[model samples]
Target: MLNYEGIAASKGYAIANAYKLVHPNLSFSTMKIGNPSKQVKRLNNAIKRAVNDLNKIEEVVITNMGSASSEIFKLQATFISSPNFINEVSSVIIDSKVNAETAVSEILERRISKLKNAGNGKFVLDKIKDIDDIRKRLLAYLLNKNMSDLALIQSPVIVVSEDLTPNDIIQLSNKNVKGVIADLGTNTSHSAILTKSLNIPSIFGLNNISKNVSNDDLIIVNGMSGEVIVNPSNELVKEYSLKITKYNQTEKPLDKLKKRNAFTKDGKKIGINANISSPKEVNLIKNYMIDGIGLYRTEYLYIDSYSLPTEDEQFNVYKNILSSMNNKPVVIRTLDIGGDKQVPYLDNNDSSERNPFLGNRSIRFSLSKTIIFRTQIRALLRASIYGNLSIMFPMISELNEWYKVKKIINEEKRKLDDGGIAYKNPKLGIMVEVPSVAIMADQFAKNVDFMSIGTNDLIQYVMAADRGNPTVAALDNPLNPALLRMLERVVNVANAYKMDISLCGEMACNRYALPILIGMGFKNLSMNINSTLDVKALLSLLDYSLMQKMSEEIIKNACTVKDVIKIEQRFIKI
Candidate 1:
């Protein structure tokens, strides 16, 4: 047996022959020329076909996943049909005296170049991938060549690739895709996100898995542990095969937990909620016993479009989510942009700063750009009338930032009142992602209706390490003794103030952090939609008293992450 290690992107188990994902040769000479009118006609015809192809993929995503997952295709379709895009490509064909294929390639390259120079934010980086897909797809149509045929996949196989784009990942859905292993991807990569959303067993950043594998190589991918074994002997294959079977058996019973509320054996209950981006993501929780939408990232509403979403457009999306949940608690976070996200319209100068992550971002960016902030606040306020709503401000490091957001929200509410618009006063909250906020939780709790610990940022900020940087990624562990102590203090404050507090981050779904959270008095835990069931199932098997005991020991004796991990491992076995 040959073994390889990788970063786990999505969790499951698979044993199958490897099927390599390919990047088709769409390369063509830019000097190729044709009759000007003929080239323009071919360009128009290719655009129409590409749009049709996108629409079909969008349908597949919506049917198998949800409409939220299909937003990429919608954006593609909109861009392709836009007047500016059409004009630019057609002008290239006629003015440059080039073939339609060459014209499309040139325009796509120009767009990609523009995006590449748009600094390092995820918004620009994601668009680079989107435009790359468009370039290949359109050129293939013009040249009458085959693009990826993932949609036509017949048998179950583990997909190995140098890198899989979002467009490639989407079409592999409902097509017997056993697993996805990639040579390059991170936890936040679009391909990684898509695989997780589609519930496919996947691992990425395998270095050379794509190059080493052969046509007949049998692969066993354990997405849970990020392990891959190639050409294992009969005994080992049988062992791993049984593990997969047992894993499936265990998962089946977890689904039956849908209607059941999560509670400790001692009868203490905890709220299990989902972190979502778009409004249509509510559809993803229909089969699960989700307490509510804990973290509704409103950033996608702006990110999904070419221009800023108007007040009406934002309001409708918010309304749909609230109405769908039927008065269930929906905590809508106001545009948490400018950190890893950026847009050209929003004075993107800050995005070019030396340390953009520490620069203007989240609530900071919102306050600086009042129009964008107020527009979003007004829409969120209007949507409050539809169902239970809690509006949250993210990355508020100080009390002053908290006060500014509230003042602006009140100003918006007043304008709504003057306009005779019906709106509800939403329960206000702040994310405790900043160490400053976590330390001052007592004071912040006194002001806000609730608090949520955004551990994704909190850990990185507190540790002074970027999780994306491999050299310092180990520092991002939630098991760090100082973070646990800080969380204990925050949870204690919330309990003392009688305020609702929850954690909505990757930490919330992590098993190692589960006991510590509940033991520290957290009654609410919000994570990705698919993770709710696993957490809920584990919640039932735990005893609140034992968890509290274990937490007490770790808080006192665990001075390092290694100590905490050791304690957790020992307790997990018990």
Candidate 2:
């Protein structure tokens, strides 16, 4: 048996034959065009087809993994579908007077140069990979050639690739693909996220993993430990086969929690909600005992196209999601688009902002254009009659901002009433992302129906660090004394008013933070659908009352990350 070790990307065990996936040749020489108009038409059609393929793959990913894993593809589709993209392609076709393929290859190559200038950091490197994927998709379609479609494979095989793209990893998940071995990517990469979403045993960061393996070679992949064995001895295979059975036995218990409600040891019911972006993800989590859809990221509705989704279109999607929950609460946060999430189609998106994250984002952009805000509110209100719907606004930094948004909602409601449209009144809420709101949580609690602490931004805003940027990403810590204090204050106010309060940020997914939040008296908790079961399983073992007392000491005495860690370790041992 020959063994190799790499970074574990996804947890599972697989024993199958190997299939090597190689990158397609995207290089093409510039050729003279017959007609500029015809070439432009051809380029446009190719782009449309590419964007369509990305969209379909995105839906499959969302259904399989939820919205976060699907985001990479969504971004790729948004880039290709933008007017700016087509305009540049058209300019190249006319200016260079070259064939459609040559124009595309040239434009993409020029983009590569601009991206290279951005820097060689991990983020830049990831973008380069994304561009490469886009380049491959466009060239393949234009040239009428097929790339490896693992979905078409009839039997199970372990895929080995030089560098797995989001496109490649997702396609590998079609069926009969037992595992993935890739030479590039870390657990944080888009490729890794796709493999995990598909529940494929995958190991990335292997050196020339593709070159070392041959097609139909017997392979064993242990994703939990990042172990890959080629042509293992019969004894070794039998041993791992038992381990796989044991591993699956442990995982199936979490599946039992699918139909089980989340309750603390003391019989206190805790809410476990889903934070999803697209309506389609609702189908994946509906069977789980999620309290509700805590956050419906409406920005995805805008990112999928060159123009905004019409009121009817938004209404239908919202209705489907709300209906699927069957009277369970659904919190739809309206248009949190800006910062890392951008929609170029909207005229109101201010590209010139020096620091876009802190300026004209979320509620600010939504309010900047009342028509856009009104249209969404009208849709949400119309859909409210179908199930329990709560409308939440993001990035409200002031009481007046909340008041201004409420005024717009009132206007939309009146317009619906005037048109004789039947709509139920939804519980109105605001995301407590800004420090200003968290500082005055008590004051705001009086004005809103509920509060959801979006710790992803609150921690960053409080710490003055961008989570997306690696240089300062560590400082965006949920365990920071400052952030913990702010969170403590918000939950206290929510407890005082008997209002529905929940943590729906990245912190909610943190296992360490979970017990602390529950101890701090958070009955309502929301996180990604993928993490929901684990959180619930943990809930049954936790004594909420005991956690509440432990949280008090951590809040009072824990001063640093190390301090928090020490105290949590002591408490967990109990």
Best by lDDT: 1
Cα error of candidate 2 at position 263, Å: 1.5
Clashing pairs in 1: none
Give the lDDT of residue 217 in candidate 2: 92
lDDT (tens digit, per residue) of candidate 2 on 148-193: 6564566889999877643465467566889998886555344565
Writing each residue's lDDT as its tens digit, candidate 1 over 310-366 gives 789889999999999989999999888765566554555454888876988888888
Scored by TM-score, the top model is 1
lDDT of each: 0.81, 0.80
List candidate 2 stretches off by more than 4 Å.
1-30, 33-245, 347-352
Q: Give the TM-score of candidate 1.
A: 0.85
Error of 2 at 153 (Å): 8.0
